[model samples]
Target: MATLNFKHLRYFWMVAKTGSIARAAEQLHLTPQSISGQLTEFSATLDVELFRRAGRNLELTEAGRRILSYAEEIFTIGDELLEVLRDQKVKKTLPFRVGIADNVSKLIAYRLVEPALKLGEQVRLVCREGRLASLLAELSIHRLDMIIADRQMPANLNVRGYSHLLGESGLSVFGTSGLAKELSGSFPALLDNAPFLLPGEDVAIRPKLIEWLETSNLRPRIVGEFDDSALMKAFGQAGAGLFVAPTAIVDHVCEQYKVSVIGRIDAVVEHLYAITTERRLTHPAIVAISKAAREDIFGVGKD
Candidate 1:
């Protein structure tokens, strides 16, 4: 009903998106009191009740929800406009937020993202690790620029996203030096009754690993199951059990974790994908990652 102050609208939008003014303040780099003052003024200017408190969180009122819809659209369009005008010459660093699925090896994720940093100082990389479904939810809401996952987007998800195959690599079984030496006998046959650390059922490679083990007629004793690949590797490094990792990072893993390769699982490959909302990649940082992954990073299985 009155002339809009977009600055106030932006504060409100951030608060609404984040669910609390304090959290929004943290993201916007402002004090909570200052944001609260701005929000009070904003509500006064509009002569509408914007929020209602619900426990520790702020619940949007009917008017607030309506306003948020417009605010999100406004900011999204504003973002698109800025993207179109963005240039390397511009001093402002563009934020590229990526979500890495927890099951993905940290070594592989770092390699996939390292190329983006080497491109230039113009990109600000922000990384978050979580489950693929959670990351997909964030992507659907535009909270994440992209997600790194071991597989393609599920066909059942209602969220719209494009899966870009960055690269794929076969896996390798690894164990501590002493453990590997002890188990060194005859390939898959040596795996029989060997202490094995398996990926959790939620992981894409878990079933593949089970199938491989069964087909090879090797029944390794399950030492533990882990949802976090890095943690699983740590267990393997400590001689807790043998674990599997992407062969593309075999050397890196051996050096970092002080482990030795027991064998290679070339039949079961792990595919990496960059899942984004756009079918065509427009983000320069992401483009660099894709190029590097396909050309240099996972170009060949290290095994």
Candidate 2:
């Protein structure tokens, strides 16, 4: 057998992590045709079929599943080796590239992560706001050291990555006192009949909200869509429509804009998660920040 090529391992890793050739290709910035061909080449070199279709999706064959275990172990060791080599040459403060989901408020991000600067270790914290899928892609490539997400964890997350639950908070329906007053009906009935200010189409909020509404058989009439949460709250405060936001934002809007929290949408509870590549987890700086998040942010006591 020929020696295993890094290209084959890379393609296989992405496929296993994303669970879809199409999605993994998008993440890797490669054509689906190219990814498929590379995967085929990988399997051929190994003298085995790696995966087979299961309905509309693909699942690992028995041989593929066995290979996955070894692949994960190899990748982790490879990453750790690279980190050690880089550290010896650079000798700078340890750097951690972190990502946060857009649904999380800026204030929440500041509150949760700003304390990391207090740590004595030479540290660099790089933060960005984006959706879960993109953030995970950056993690897979090692562009980001970790991610903090409020929702939308991908189903095919790589085994070489790990996750920690930071906290849970419910999302609520909020709007100007005038909007709530104008509805003049029970909370459930008002939600069914009132105009709603919502995040634009293609945002994760839309699907989750729609799912929750369907369960109640209540469909809201959307008046407008805005990408900025602050602007959405402003429109809601002016009695334009009801807006969905997290508790922290709702609390802030209530005090600043005098918006009323007509009712809490119990179905929309959000969970915060910290995700990191397996190699980064063992570092002292990553360990410290993760500890802070789990304890201070999630209310989990440190071991």
Candidate 3:
């Protein structure tokens, strides 16, 4: 009904994300009562209830959902404005929030992200790590500028954007020395009678791993089914079970744990890809960073 302030939009966005005024206030470092007051004022001005209580949880009504979409767009535009203003030599410093899949090792992800942070004094790089699906969802909603993910993300993944495959990289099975010693020969044979720390059934890699196990006539004694590779490695390091991970991650795990590379699987090479919206592709910073990443960082030539 009236021109809204940026703070109101920000508060609204936070509440939409957190689903609770109290939690949103905590995140924004404002009082819950203040947030409630602002929301009340906003609702009155707009002549609509932005949110309603569904028991203890705050549920967004239709009006609230519509307004939230506009808020997201406004925030994106605001960020573009800041980027343009900064490009004019004002030296605005805002971190570029980059997301990566959890399948990537922490060490590898950090290595890739750290160099990108050194691009400019004002170019702060914020890394958000999660599974491929979650990272892509965040990217679609403009919560992330770009994401490093597997190439398996389909063209019809509702991305409504462009994605570039970085390159193919090898991933392999690895386990601690204690676990490795238990294996008779190659990985296929080791599956039987071994305590296995495996990815969850829903994971993309699960079917392939299952097929591989079946071909070897090996049925692993399942110890855990994890979605988190780091946690899998932790369990493996503690001698709970053997973990199968990417070869790129093997060296790092070996150094940290008593792990060894028992065997390598080159056929199942996982690909790295960079994904971004068409609009964001034109942003100077985005263009520069993507170019640098392709030409130097994770570049095929470099690899």
| Candidate number with greatest lDDT | 1
Tens digits of lDDT, candidate 3, 145-218: 87866555666678755676655555676677776776785666766888888887544566777777787688
Q: How well does each candidate superpose onto the true structure, as a TM-score? A: 0.74, 0.57, 0.69
Models, CA RMSD each: 6.2, 10.9, 5.6
The TM-score ranking, best first, is 1, 3, 2
Q: lDDT (CA) for every model shown?
A: 0.89, 0.73, 0.72
Task: For candidate 2, list the clashing residue pairs, or say none.
Answer: none
Worst 10 residues of 3 by lDDT: 294-303
For model 2, what is the alpha-carbon lDDT of residue 191? 87
For candidate 2, lDDT tens digit of each residue in 1-303?
478888788888889887889998999999999999999899888889988898766788888876785687578667766886978764345565778876665555665676667777656676767877777876787777778766545667663577766666667888776667677678777788689987765345567777888898887898998765667777887888998776645656578767778887767766666777763467565566667666765456646
Error of 2 at 9 (Å): 30
Model 3: residue 243 alpha-carbon error in angstroms:
1.3
Candidate 2 deviant stretches above 4 angstroms: 1-94, 156-160, 200-205, 226-231, 248-250, 253-258, 279-303
In model 1, the worst 10-residue window by lDDT is: 84-93
